[model samples]
Target chain A: MSRIVLRNLVKSYPGGDRRATDEISLEVADGEFVVLVGPSGCGKTTLLRMVAGLETPDSGSVHIGDTDVTSLSARDRRVSMVFQSYAIFPHMKVRQNIGFGLMMRKVPRPEIDRRVADAAAMLDLSDYLDRFPSQLSGGQRQRVAVARAIVVDAGVLLMDEPLSNLDALLRLQFRAELKRIVHQIGTTTLYVTHDQAEAMSLGDRVAVMRDGRVAQIGGPLEVYDSPADRFVGSFLGAPPMNFFPALVSDGPALSVGALSIPAPSSLARFAGRTVLVGVRAEKLAVSTDAADGFLPATVEVVEPTGASVLLTVRLGDHELKVQAPPTFDTRPEASVWLRADPSTMRFYDPETSLALTV
Target chain B: MRRFALQVFCVAISLFMAAPIYLITLAAFSSRESLNEFPLPLVPTDPSTETLSGFLSSTGVIAGGVNSLMVGLNTVVLALLIGLPAGYAVARYAFRGRQPYQLFLLLTRALPIVVLSVPLARIFLTTGLYDTTYAVTLLHTALALPTTVLITAAVFVAVSPEQEEAAQIFGASPVQAFVRIVMPQALPGIAAAAVFTFVMSWNEVLGAAILTLNQRTLPAQVLSTLSFSPLAYRFAGGFALVVPALLFIAIMRKYLLNMWGTTLK
Candidate 1:
């Protein structure tokens, strides 16, 4: 099936309190592109390394295409890795870099040339094939790295933050190109990145990681709209999700200090108990009228970003970021009402931080 | 203003290093009669090849020079053959005792040559390699190895470990990855180490003197008789010794400066 299965993996560095990767298990179906996204040191890269056989787990097994590959070395496992630094064999020309794997596998000379040419053509690197990495631009060098990875047609491709090294504009451009190529080629890929936005746009399914464990694994929007915990909600959004504590009251409402609002019915059983409320900036709409579920807030700052205006609003003692349409003219210190849909807001147990399913 | 001052500082440093070499060359070429004058003329006065020719034609001079060249070249080969892999191990692997092992390699350099030479000479005498280039070659290799290993290891460390990992991921075995990925990129460092080893072996006198008698290297030949020889002959010997080392550096200057290629792209 060419599927990748990582079973109960655990790895720890010397003298570290927490494992780099806890008993983590994951699967990547054939032709699927799964991204492991997290904050730095969350073990996403380590887990990907374990799958590629660059790292051996303390206890676990890796299986690829129905064969146990835990004991196999990376060379024998037939997986290609694109390193974050591009690692483009700086000494070699672009043509040789793309053909290196086939050469090592003892492919015939003409066949290596043909495959390298094909890869170069696919990556739009035909003109630069004779140039060394030093002669190419940063974005072009990364294309060579990707070309090198895909030329071998390895069943699985492991990329460790391949786009993180590029500048913002180049990164955005490469992101779309990479997704188009990966989907067209249908190679199973396990990509690791600290940037959550890249994870959202590229992966068929995204696995959010925290403290060496998978926090949540689902389709990007599914995880974004309904996070498994406070960490995932705060991590995946731009400007991030706003978090504040609220008390569930028997009035079938939530109370944050003096302000009271209707609560999602799922929290009715937990009345008088504290819950952490999470809301994305885009989810909170600014209402002109005192409509249902509208809370009084004072606009603290207005930041116009062309397409939308980002407003920092103070509701009681809490500061919440609200994304408003650019046409909405609101200045600092202006009193306004912000409305949030009860179903769109996520609630978690205050101490445990686990989401309360509604 | 700052750039001009920095340029003057750099020029001053270069001149300070080059002055002795200039004086040595002038003294070696001048006739003995001109050298006898107080505060001798500094600008190639009475230019002659008499003293240098005399030194070159002395007993065992040509053979000793040839022997020094062979020993220097052999030492370069032997040290690199043994040291490169040891250096690669230190650079790539994180096994137990890795730090201590590198420190231990450096510590071996602290042992005095006087202490090592006697036992080494005795062993060579028993092994029938005494008074031969091989005995001197082996001794020089020992002296050159620590520098070779440490410098190459530093260079290997500069090479992104990701490149080697990328090679292995692409299908090269560990050894193959080092050959195909690490070695090509490590050439400039290897060249630098070679330059240092060649210069050290060509100039080293104490070990060569103690270890070999009839079959002496150029440095040992100069040391044995230069005390009784005239001042002009001594200058000639110094000039001769400096030329080859200078030539080796000049030949290797290109690789030494082109080291930034190994860094990540």
Candidate 2:
């Protein structure tokens, strides 16, 4: 029944001119999983630390369930944290590490042992209960960290880039495992990571932070499909959404160089002004046929990533990336036709960078 | 061929280092008559317990041994008690003048012990603590504290702060986090620091000699009385002085290994 609420949390380091976390406010429902994702130094980690009571906000309050835990120490806050480095006690065996929280609370030895065993079994670590952290592989150590956090049964769990240290294959495998485990435990989790893919896959809701403030927060598909601004649109997707400076004509047609394409009717009000037309790489369809509406371009680079082929194309002075199906064959230096779907195209005001909605 | 040459060179250096200790051991166990015969014996011709037994029985030697042991143990306890927390503070927390404080500790070491010893002796006399093991231990702790702080700080720094934070998040208070997570990880280095402090106190002569009269440490007693003692007694006294230092290292060898080997992951 733990619901987390942050109210205008602002934290700034002494030496830095910029605030580490600036006026961030959000609410997480009971047993909700929310991920804060951004580039490094974007304060996602800072925001999560504030919630865990590891970092104090200069001005604001943090509430967990019904308690205002802003002034409480991390121990009194009743939260469990998983660090990026795992932070497993190297001197202790897996069993002792998992039971450390319960031990700290003066739980009975038998009960501690039972809970440790339960957590170890859940993480598939029962066989290695006697082993030290140094003896385990990277993935196993991460699981041990998770087991340690969950064994405490704290309502709120904070994870800071937990999968960042693992190799790619292991990261993918553990990403699923972590999501499944958190879901099963039903803890209100606030996870911070710089990886957008991890955010999308693991979080029930994704919060995109930039420069110490949350730029956008919504469901993953909602964010990906309708990003709030240019930064959110550009930061969330792979290869990023392409932005082109275009002028909206009387017919609300976007004119890029000598190429013209019909803009969505919603953009008609913004006619006769320069706007940034945003299109996802996957939204741009590449075809060999030079149809009436298709813009002709030369393929500059062809990259095949097993399932999809990414093509870097030159349209006049602009280079646009397009993601096509793996079967689409186009060698570098070949001429191709690019078609933009008007419905998927987003319009942004160049000055404010905010998306323009009808 | 290069590797073989390097190995031979290393062995040669080791033997050179061990030569003095070997000579002392030889003379310590040699009969008094054998030691008196010129051209000091390369090896003990007649190895006997006579010289060691005689040295041990001499006036003040046994008492001095007890005083030295007391001083060394007390010095280590005092130095670590003060130094460990200071070291952890410097390592983990950021404060104004921290760098200057560390530098000041180093600066205290650069000053000759004789400079401090005279004033310290005067104060000890005034305080009615003169000629006691306590006076020697206090001076030795002052000498060892700088090293203790630096070593323990380095050790604590090697233990990741994230681990302590993780511990706190798991319901441990700050002190509990330090005791449970950081302290165990830092034990090896702290043990190494303790050994160093013990050896420093054991081998210290000038401060011990200046600070005490009747309750003189082994080194102070040996140095003060060495001029009149026989060569056999001198060698035996020197050998006796070396024993505790060697034993301290031996006991802490596992921690020393840990300091050099495995990094805390």
Candidate 3:
């Protein structure tokens, strides 16, 4: 296993204007599963492909350990990739597909068999060894793709949204299984996906990307708890973090519409300045009685999601969503009060979308 | 109800096509004693192999069939040799003048093969390759190339690039990836394209007749000897040509649906 480093990697199409991969840099430690996550066209996949050497960087260099691999071809780099469509050769049996790299290297038949069997066993694909890809289910085909990569014995593995094609249940199951398999092998992996859940679950560290650049790179929770900017914070969670246009009013409070929430005291120096206040739904509380820095509001909608209820409340023209116990039933026009756990409230400059010092 | 009507329409069309061939076979098989009979019989009173044998005995006719097979196989091999890599390059790579190269191929198809045969023959004679099998096969490429390139392009297109990319990532070079992954996936279509190439070469006459004299392909032989040729010999030669058409479709029946579907697009 070796660390992979990308430095100022840039890729622009021939005679084309936009940069597909901008001057971005990242590092994946030995045995680390680093996932690059973003929306489509954010250049996460392009960056991964460049590292695998399927794509050449217009400039900049990629290093595996201390070796510069910028000019290396994909085959020379010894980086295995599991593609989105599970590109198993249709004519080859599962075993042959898994053993292709070994065959190419002229590995002896018995060794190829042993490695194929080992990979098949690891991926639970041994029983389907003789079957073709067409005979396999989507999940099974994915396992075959994984087996093919693992059998190559390459130190680095790149996967581009490999689970995106599977159904929800299969994706979740394979997400767990993939982590277990990759962890056992300890190959350095660079995974790319647009799904935040997959990124959070699979990556030892996740790189959140936006507009062809790394917005932030940290342990999943670190990026989630303290995103570098508004985009990272907004992109890292489900139902997403809520942002309110507000002004940092006097007396440790930020006002949004007719509602005001207590701001941390450290932010008092920025009083009377326009700011953005963000809070995850889980951190906002709803109650019947108003408290200090809490606002009374009318509930507009209550959505029950089996385990929790999401209450959409109207506070003047601004709306806030609060996650509460499913049993905490409320109806439209019902009166409620909203409070932000001050410690969890994220503050940003409204104009620049940059996080505030506090 | 509408589907049944469509099925009937299709059967009607099939019979419409088969009817003439059926009448021709009947006429060709009828004995020489019945030659002047009018309102031709639907079936001959006695079918005999004599006509086919006599047709084979005709001057240079049988040899022409052998030449046709040689020329057709040669065309298939050469076209695939040149067109396969050209198709792959055009489909997978982007370089300067790639679109122009494609436009040039299309332009070749637009200019009639007949117009170029005279010029090509002169060049072949200069090269001292005239009247040889190589000359005939090379000339066929002019007719075979456009279809070969286009057909192989479609074949390569249907094969997803991700598969080849996956192979490269798994420590296989581009050539290895194409051979191990892309080519296998594209095989069925490639086979169909090869058949199309063979058919084009086999049926081509105007160019072959003008280009070669002593070494003539089936169509050239048929045309050269059509005047004063026995009726049985003409029909037998026609029958032999139709044999390849039948074999072509039969051999590719499984892939025909896909081939036709792609070609129509």
Off by over 4 Å in 3: B28-30, B94-107, B122-130, B262-265
Ranking by lDDT: 2, 1, 3
The two-chain DockQ for each candidate, comma-separated, is: 0.85, 0.83, 0.76
Identify the superior model by TM-score, candidate 1 or candidate 3. 3
- Across B1-265, the per-residue lDDT of candidate 1 in tens digits comes to 9999999999999999999999999999999888899988889868999999999999988999999999999999999999988887777778888878877878988999889999999999999999999999999999999888877877888788888889999988888888888888888789889888999999999999999998999999999997798999899999999997799778877766655444311
* Model 1 lDDT per residue over A1-358, tens place: 2789988899998878999999999999999999999999999999999888889999989998888999999998878889999998989999999999999889999999999999999889999989999999999999999999998999998899999989999999999999999998899999999999999999999999998899999999998888899999989988789888999998679887777888878788888888899999999989656766678899999999998999999988889999999899879998889877787789988889999876
- Can you write out model 2's per-residue Cα lDDT over A40-138, one digit (the tens) per residue? 999988899888888989999999999999999999988998999999999999999999999988899999999999999999999999999999999
Return the candidate ranking by TM-score, descending. Answer: 2, 3, 1
Stretches of candidate 1 off by over 4 Å are B1-19, B30-53, B94-112, B115-132, B230-232, B257-265
Native A-B contact fraction in model 2? 0.90
The DockQ leader among the candidates is 1
- Using lDDT, give the best candidate's number: 2
Per-candidate clashes come to: 0, 0, 0
Interface RMSD, every prediction, one decimal place: 0.7, 0.8, 1.2
Which lDDT value does model 1 have at A73?
95
> Candidates' lDDT values, in order?
0.90, 0.90, 0.86
User: How do all models score by TM-score?
Assistant: 0.92, 0.96, 0.94
